[model samples]
Target: MQAVILAGGKGKRLAPYTTILPKPLMPIDDMPILEIVLLQLKKHGFTNIVLAVGHLAGLIQAYCGDGSRWGLNITYSMENEPLGTAGPLSLIDGLEENFLVMNGDLLTNIDYSDLMKLHLEKNALATVSMYNKDVPISLGVLNLDDSGNIIDYIEKPTLTYKVSMGIYILNRKILDHIEKGKYLDFPVLIKQLIEENEKVVGYDFTGYWMDIGRHEDYSKVLEEFNSIRDELL
Candidate 1:
């Protein structure tokens, strides 16, 4: 199977640390987060990998040269300018009929093979890996009816939403919706697909997952890594 890791982001949210190293290169425990991602993909039987790189691309290329160390065939797709999220897919060549795409800064134990299996089983143009996230509201939320009448109130309630995990399985045909040399985020691309009545689906995952792009999340990973290291690696 083939996989494309989006490792090009400037990671402005991660400032000073990202000022020195790209988000994918940021260390987790013993190695960079991107290394862990590669290991997981390889374990799931994805040998052909393409790293869509920019923003300190040289460092990533040097550190992961050829991917021979991990018994994977790794290639690069350099972005001279920012390509948002899905735009970089246009820059990559020779993508398989269906391939996996994901952000490189994530730490998760998701089964990539299973994700692909679901995509194939459903014959979907795109499959988004989803996680149900519970967001707590500190203040009360109100429901209003027509004419601005307050209908119901829930005090400091929690809301659950199925959210994209920045991981996806996309068929080659889906690329037709994306234009080359343009900035297109994933959300806009998905919306366009829906507007066109393309077959897009979601794979719900209830496993351990975290995006360590913020300082607080990074700190949480540091605190919890040792406990979940076995599950992740």
Candidate 2:
């Protein structure tokens, strides 16, 4: 199977570190996050990989030359301008079947084989990997009626949502929704699919997953990596 990893983002949220290296190259222990992702994919039998790169593309290419160390083949898709998330797919070639597309900075224990199995079984146009996230409200919350009277009140309640893990298994036909050189994001593409009555499945994963897009997440993953290294590798 083939995989496309979106590693082009400037990662402004992780500024100081990203100033030197791309977010995908940021170390989680001694290994770059993307290296971990590649090793995991290689373990799962994905040999052909495409790295979508922009900011500091040279450094990434230098670090992961040919993917020979992991026994995988890698190709680079250069983005001259920011193409959002989904737009980069339009620039790649030979995606005739279903492929896995994910953000490069992810740290997760998701089984790629299981995700592909579900995608095939459902015959979905796109299968999104979802993670349950609980966001806590630090302040008091209130519910109001139509007349603006408070019907209920609560304090520091946590809201749970099945959020995108920034991972997807998409059929090649999904590429039709993306325009060449357009800044199309995943949410917009998914919304377009929904409006067009396309089947978009969400596979709920309760395993460990983190985006590692921020400084705090980087630190958290660094602290957690050792314990989960065996599982992720």
Candidate 3:
């Protein structure tokens, strides 16, 4: 099987650590974040991997050459410029059936085999991994009327939302919705797929998952690494 990993972040939020080493190279437990992701791919019997790289692309290439050290064959899809989430996908060749794609910096214990099986069984055009998050309102929330007046109100209403875990299983046909090389975020791609009557399913993963985009998130993962090492790493 094949997989695509997005590792081209500038990582402005996790500066300094990302100033020299890219976010993917940031250490997680005994290995780099990208290495852990590579290990996960290997565990799922995916030997062909593509890293869509930019920012400090060379360093990642130097460290993960051919992916043999990790028992996988790694290729690169160089982003000539910043191509958001789905943009770089245009560069990948020969993904006929279905393929796995995730950010290089994500940490999760989702069983990839199961996710893929669901994708094929349901015949979804795309499948997204989702995480549940509850966000409490800092201010009073009001149930509004068609008029500019509020019908009812609740103080500090907590809102729950299902957020994208940034992992996806995409059928090759979905590429028809993508404008090649554009800066397309995953959500925008989803909207297009939905409008076109394409099936998009979500697989809920309640395991330890981290999107190490900011300093706080990065630090938190490091602190929890020891406790959840076996699960996330």
- TM-scores, all candidates, are 0.97, 0.98, 0.93
Clashes in predicted model 3: 0
Q: Cα RMSD (Å) between model 3 and the true structure?
A: 1.7
Error of 3 at 58 (Å): 0.6
lDDT of 2 by residue, 1-233 (tens): 99999999999999988998999999889889999999999888788999999999999999999899889999999999999999999999987599999999999999998999999999999999999999999999999999999999999999999999999999999888999989999999999999999999999999999988988888899899999999998
Q: Residue-wise lDDT of candidate 1 within 1-233, one digit each (tens)?
A: 99999999999989999987999999988999999999999999999999999999999999999999999999999999999999999988899999999999999999999999999999999999999999999999999998999999999999999999999999999779899979999999999999999999999999999998899998998889999999987
RMSD of each: 1.0, 0.9, 1.7
Q: Candidate 3 has what TM-score?
A: 0.93
Weakest 10 consecutive residues of candidate 1 by summed lDDT? 173-182
Q: Write the per-residue lDDT of candidate 3 for residues 41-110, one digit (tens) a residue.
A: 8888778899999999999999999998888989998888998989999877877578999998888888
On a 0 to 1 TM-score scale, where does candidate 2 land against the true structure? 0.98
User: Which residue runs does candidate 3 get wrong by more than 4 Å?
Assistant: 144-153
What's model 3's overall lDDT? 0.88
Clashing pairs in 3: none
- TM-score winner, 2 or 3: 2
